[model samples]
Target: MPSMKEELDQSTTPPLCKTGCGFYVNKETRGLCSSCYKADVLKKKASSEVPKILDVNNNVGNQEPVENHDQSNKVVKKKNRCHVCNKHVGVVPFSCRCGESFCRLHRMPEKHACKFDFKAAGRVVIEKQNLLCVADKLEFRFFKWWELPDMVFQSYHGWENWLDGLRLKKEVKDYLEAKIARRKIV
Candidate 1:
């Protein structure tokens, strides 16, 4: 018969870790070994503590308003609450020309029945459509600097009648020239 020690050694099963660490671990432990599980638990505890610290700092600083900070933050928080639902809004929230900050759900002036001028809105739409039509007419047309005077005269009736049809007033021409100069430099 085999010796008692040899029989016992043969019957004993090797320890195995659940995390595939190739190390011996207690059979009752799940997933990670003892050391890895402890480390993981410590990491989770640290992350949770960090968020609490951040929340504390944010609350403390915001509780009392500072002069150097954005005054709009305080104003928006207090007065610019959503006009319809009275909910607080963040920075750059949509505000109607009628002087009210509206949440995404009620951002449109018509949705809130704002007293905006419908005539002004119609004028703006007409102006935009006119601009689009002008852009479409000039889309494929290209002219060099030397051809500018000829093109302008031809497009209008002639040099003398150019001022009648052409809308380039002296102030507008100066502004456009300045803008073109700035664009060239940039």
Candidate 2:
């Protein structure tokens, strides 16, 4: 029902991206610009694709989305062999600290250039495995000679009456008598 001129005008200047990318939108893309459209396409392409990482600050000035690395080594290992490499495997396939399996040629960290800090991880393990032990000093109780006489009476229960009958030395008897008098006064 539209005229030729109307169709021409619509085709001449493609609509601005609905996402506000400032780029001309493609009708086939629904309303997004080429870059935004590509990103959306990639996001829905497969589950193995590395998810788009957003900046922490999320500056309003830059609206573009950050994508993953294109390099084979830098790209994430999605499947068994990896999405980029099509799961290519060598003779020996072993997992690394980077959370990906590598081949015989790239098994060593030096070969694949692992990002995990071996030294720091080792230090943490060592610290947990070997702990430092420190204990408090032991305490001892000392009793004076004057308190020893009282201790003897307490242990013997009723030795007060037999104290003089024991025929003890005069000095000992005098000491016991003095302690007994002190006890009666209290």
Candidate 3:
């Protein structure tokens, strides 16, 4: 048998605790150190007591039925129905500025005849124009070749411009016709 001094030395050597506490564990307790075991007991006791406290507190409230109280505490979302359709409930409803909810089919203000202020809508249009202007440089070189014919025609014709506004120069029209003829012949 080891002597008392030897036993004392072994115990004092700081072996790893099973509870991952980083410090040496007490040898008297099975695997767990005294502090960890006490913590575990306290945690279990707290968990068990929580539900009992809730139940007691719930019963002590006013004279509403238990089922009603349970349901009332829970947030029950009202199903959104379309103002126009009045039948089908929407999963993803669209809300208008006019304070009316709508389905996908009648979400637009025009579709529902909503009385939204036109001044507010004009601001959105102006913002869209500003965004387009910011996205492209206003230099003459950046102008598209396709728009050149229309721009030239519109400047001279003014009120006499065609409804489609696709007037091409006489030379360009003749060239396109010749190309189409050549393709057909081949």
lDDT of each: 0.65, 0.69, 0.66
Estimate the TM-score of every prediction. Answer: 0.25, 0.30, 0.24
lDDT of 3 by residue, 1-186 (tens): 889999999977867678798766677766677788788789989988774334655646665644425656888545498888875654778888888788888889899999989788899889888864445333333334333444554565642343234466676556544644664421
| Model number with the top TM-score | 2
User: How much lDDT does candidate 3 score?
Assistant: 0.66
Output the worst ten-in-a-row residue range by lDDT, candidate 1: 138-147
lDDT of 2: 0.69
lDDT of 1 at 17: 69
- List model 1 lDDT by residue over 95-168, tens digit each: 88887788888898778888988789899999888864344433234332323645554665644454434466
Model 2 C-alpha lDDT per residue in residues 1-186, reported as the tens digit of each score: 999999998888867998887998877888898899989888787756656667788775777755656677686534456312345664545778778786656678887778899999999999999988867422222233334455565665656555655776787668666865776622
Q: Which runs in model 3 stand beyond 4 Å of their true positions?
A: 1-80, 89-100, 124-186
Candidate 2 Cα outliers beyond 4 Å, as residue runs: 1-77, 82-87, 90-92, 139-186
